[model samples]
Target: MTDKETYQRFIDWFRRTWWDLPESVHLHPMIETYLTPEEVDLLTNIPHSSQGIEEIARTKGMAPETLEPRLRALANRGMIYESSREGSVRYRLNDSFFAMLRAALWPGRTDEATKNSAPHINRYFLDGWMDQYAEVHLKGLRALPIDRTIEDKREIMPHEDVVHVVDDKKYFCVTTCPCRHRHNLDPDMPDCPHPTEVCLHFDELAHYIVNNGLGREITREETRDILKKAADSGLVHGVSNWKDGVDTICNCCSCCCMWFESFHKLGHSASMDASNYRIQVRPETCKACALCVKRCPVDALQLRVSPQARNKFGKAAVLDPDRCIGCGVCSHKCPSQSLRLVPKDQAELTEPPRDPREYMKHYLADRKAAAAKNQNTAD
Candidate 1:
């Protein structure tokens, strides 16, 4: 096949994974930017299931020694996952979703390849790639409310509490924020002013990242410190949208976060699922500082004149419930303690799925249903 056809073949293989690239989207720029024709050829033939080099090399009709370097190169580039067990090593092709995006940029490569690919990746995301999640209720991540920012701590669940989520983890690691890193690398995109190395991971995921040279290991104390710094800088703590075994916490900013960009720029319903909590305004003590209004990532809080206003401006923050993600970024910086996270009304709350598998199931089903509905309307 021609080089273009070879890359197309590789792109088609991504369909076998959980994320199916929309038919209307052309990813050739992204695919060609980071991957060489030879690398694409090798990836096209590799098995998705994990296997030892001896087994996989035999399939490619090359000696294990000959194929080992190629596989290692791919693993280093985040095209494949490398794992070791019982002193034995194995490899597997990465999926199109997290592995494709996270693995591609998490290491924070500033090389030309990464830089050139940034615009292509960013463009594709805006050009219908994220539309797939427009109707999916179970998003890939959810906001984790800042510690001590909740109105009533007694009502907070383990999953919703940022402190509890961090305490539950045994291992900790930090990596570059892929979302910000990608945009920062792109000359055409505006730089994200927030720090890049604020992404956190735990347990087996942390080990994998450290072992792969994708991130650095840190202590639990450092993890908390980083979270604190992120909160102080107006970053939202976003975790996987599941109740258990949460692998990651992204310090997200509205300017460069994949989810936020999708919501704010692309006009999606939400960047991710709002936490079970929502921000409650104490207008009486608001001071009319408008700090919360300025810090809110989602424009959820706006200043308005009200009878409850007591400050000089005669304006207090009012919440647009539909826009709040309950991230508590606004409340964390509130000078007068006028903003706090409160449990959403029972009728408005939606629990996250039990785990990643369940999240994927619900997400795919909803996306499929949305696609069908759109198709019907078009017809």
Candidate 2:
């Protein structure tokens, strides 16, 4: 095969691996922007799953030792994940393009390629994800709030406590929000004034970020401190959609978040389901301070005419279910505690797909079925 075919094959493999990802005509070129020609050839050598190099070595007519530098280079760049199995080292490609994009942005701790390529990479990556919006779509982080934010009459579950998730972690790492960082990089985009060191990582993910130069490991107390500041800034506390053993917490503002900006600014529909709880309003208690309105990331809460509103504001906080992400952002900011999170109509809040890959597979199947039915109807 020609070099062009070799590169195309690698791109095809990537598309198949990220099966849910939308096709970007510029994706292959964007990849070329980072990886050198030799590196691209090396990537084609690495299979989609974990494998030891001994067999590949024999096929290449060289010892695994000869490939060690290349293998280590790829692993250090966070392209392939390294693991130990039965005391032998094996490798596999990293789980998702989201992870790959970060590793690509940072390049290496010392690498200078990204100094200029960062802009191109960020722009192309955003475009690609938007083009194939669904496949590259993230299971959005669901916002969580402190117990004090809930109204006194509201039912608060121990499991629903945001701090509980924080306390349960054996490890923590703080990183700059990549979404915010990407925005700040572009001269055309408005700079985000929010604190940058607010991304909270946990467990194996913490270890991964620390090892990959994506984030710095930090003390638990520091982690808690950042969370506090994030709340004070009216940033939403969100965890990954995984219901159990969650590994991520992001303090998001609507302007800079991957989910919100894509939906609100870029015109891509948010593929994420709302959290289990939807926001509620007690008009009688509301001050209509519009604090919630200002803090609401999704414009879900509004100030409307109210006879019971306490001040000259002459309005009360009201929730529009159609607009709420169930993120609880408005609830966190309401001084009168008018907003509360209630278990969403279980029927309305369905479970998030376990992971992107499975989500894509299921999405394709559903689409195929729909298309077949439509064909029958047309006949």
Q: Whole-model lDDT, candidate 1?
A: 0.86
Which of the numbered candidates is closest to the native, going by highest lDDT? 1
Q: Which model scores highest in TM-score? A: 1
Q: State the lDDT of candidate 2 residue by residue for 1-379, as single tens digits.
A: 6767767766665665643345666566556655676776777646567778886566446689987668767766667766666877776656336544554433233244443444555566566564444433344465565445654424544346776778889998887776676666656678888887788888866776676566788888898889888888878777776556677888887887767776676666562446667788888888777888888888878899988776677789878887776666677767777888777765775565565455556656655665587799999
- Residue 326 C-alpha lDDT in model 1: 90
Clash count of each predicted structure: 0, 2
Relative to the true structure, candidate 1 reaches a TM of: 0.95
TM-score of 2: 0.81
Model 1: per-residue Cα lDDT over 1-379, one tens digit each = 8998998888888667767777644478887888899888888867888899999988889899999888887777778888888999998888866665788788998888888888888888888877778888777889999886888998778888888899999999999998998899877888888888999999977887887778889999999999999999999999988988999999999899888898899998888778988889988889988778778889998999989988988889999998999989999988898888889888987888898888888988997899899999999
- C-alpha lDDT of residue 60 in model 2: 44
